[model samples]
Target: QLDDDLVSALKGALSGSLEALILGLMKSTAQYDASELKASMKGLGTDEETLIEIVCSRNNEELAEIKRVYRDMFKKDLEKDVAGDTSGNFAKLLLALVQTRRDEPSNVVDYEKIDEDARALYEAGVKRKGTDVVTWIEIMSQRSVPHLQKVFERYKSYSPYDMKESIRKEVKGDLEKSFLTLVECFENRQLYFASRLNEAMKSKGAKEKVVTRIIVSRCEVDLIKIRTEFKKHFKRSLYQTITEHTKGDYQKALLSLCGGDD
Candidate 1:
C-alpha cells in the first residue's frame, strides 16, 4: 500500500512556482502563464526543491498527465519545456522517471555487451580499464535484475568457467568479492544478497563503495521499491542488511533511500 503520508503530500496544494503547481495538473501546456502557475502554486507556495521532488520522484503516467495538462493549457510541448527547464543528473533522473518502461529491448543486448561480458570473463576476468568491480556492482544494483539474468546467460555461453567463479579467480581483494556477490545472488537474490553483502563487508572499506553508489545517485523514484525487492529476494531485512554491512554518513543516506532504520 502507498504510504498515507505520501498520499497526503500528493494531495497537497501548489504555490505560484511552475514546479509546485505542476504535480496537481491532470494535464498541462507550455503556453501556460504565470497566473496558471500562480493559481497552481499559490496557496501552498512551491519552489525548485519541491518541483524536483515531484517531477523527478513521480512515475511516467503521473508526469504524463501533468504534461498533457501543460500542453492543453499552454498549447506547447512538455518535453521541450522539460528539456529547456532541466539538465544533468536531475534531468536524467526525471527523464528516467518519464520513461517508466524498465524492460530491456531484446535487440538492446544483440551480441556486443554479451561478447564484452564474456570476453571480459574469458580474457582479463575483471573487464576493467573503466570496466571494473565498481562498474559491475552499479549496473546490477541499478538496472533491472532480469537484464542481469540475460547477461549471465550470455556469460555462461562465453566461457567454460562461470562468470562469478572467473571473477573470483581473476580479480583480487574485496573488489572481486563484491562483483561475485552481485552475480551469484542475481538468481536467488532475496535468498542471498544481504548475507552475501555481510560476507562481502568483511573486507576493509568495501561497504563504503556500496553506500556511495546508492546514496549519491539521488534516485528517489522507485528506489525504495528496489530495496523492497532486494529484501524480498535476499530473505533479510534491508536495514539490518545495510547496518551489518556499513558504517557512518554514507550508510545513513543509503538507509534513508532504502527507507530503512539508520
Candidate 2:
C-alpha cells in the first residue's frame, strides 16, 4: 500500500543507479561484504553487509575503528570502493554518507550549506519520500550526531525559524511535523526532541505524530535516551504518554522499540 507516488520515486532512483552498477554488484558481492575480498579484488566485490552494518551500527567512536580497518584490510580507501560499486542517485546518496563519515563535533558551520541541505531535503522528503528516504537514511545514519547538529542549527538559522513553528507557518499536513521531528531528533538527540515534546504537552496538545516519528525512526538507535527525554521534558513518564495517545500496533511498536529495556 505504498501508493503510486512512493513506487515511482523508488523506481526513479533505481533506474538512475545504472543497471550495470547493480548487476556488477549482484554478481560477485554475494551480500555486500567487501571485507572477504582480497586486496586486489576489493573494488570488484560489494561488501554491503559490512558497510551498511557499520554505517547503521557504529557511532563516531567505533566508526573510526571500522574505517581504519577497512582501509588497512582493503589496501585502498573505503570511499573508492563504494564509488566503484554504486552509481546515480544511490551512489550520490551513499557517497554523501561515506564522505561525511560521522556526526562528530565541528568548530564552525557554514549556513549556506544548510540552505542547500534544506533544498535537498525539500526535494527528497516532501517532493519525493521513497527514494529520498534511502538517500536521507544513508546520510543521517552514516553521519555522526555532532556533525548533524551543525546542519540542524544552521538550518534553523538560515530559515530563521524553529521547526515546530515553521511547520505551523509554512507547511500543512500531519506528516510534515513528523519529518521535521525526524530531522531534529537525528541532528541532536539530547536537545531537539525532548524539548519539543515537553513544550508540546505543556503549551499545546501533544501530537501523536511527533511521538510516532521519533519512536519509529530512532527507537532502535536510542530508546533509553528517548525515554529520558520524554520524562525530562514533559515531566511525565513516557509510558504515561504512550497510554494517553496511542494503542494497538503503534503502541506495540513503540514498546518493542524500547527494545525490551522497559
Q: Which candidate tops TM-score?
A: 2
Deviation of model 2 at 204, angstroms: 40
lDDT for each residue of candidate 1 in 97-158, tens digit (9 for 90 to 100): 44444343354644666566455545444333433443443344444455667677777776
Q: Candidate 2 lDDT, tens digit per residue, 62-86?
A: 3444456666655677667666775
Predictions: Cα RMSD each: 13.1, 15.2
* Model 1 TM: 0.32
Q: For candidate 2, what is the lDDT?
A: 0.48
Q: Give the best candidate by lDDT.
A: 2
lDDT of each: 0.47, 0.48
Candidate 2 global TM-score: 0.34
Clashing pairs in 2: 32-47, 32-48, 32-49, 33-47, 33-48, 34-47, 102-144, 103-143, 103-144, 103-147
TM-score, per-candidate, Cα-based: 0.32, 0.34
Q: State in Å the error of residue 214, model 2.
A: 20
Q: How many clashes does the backbone of model 1 have?
A: 23
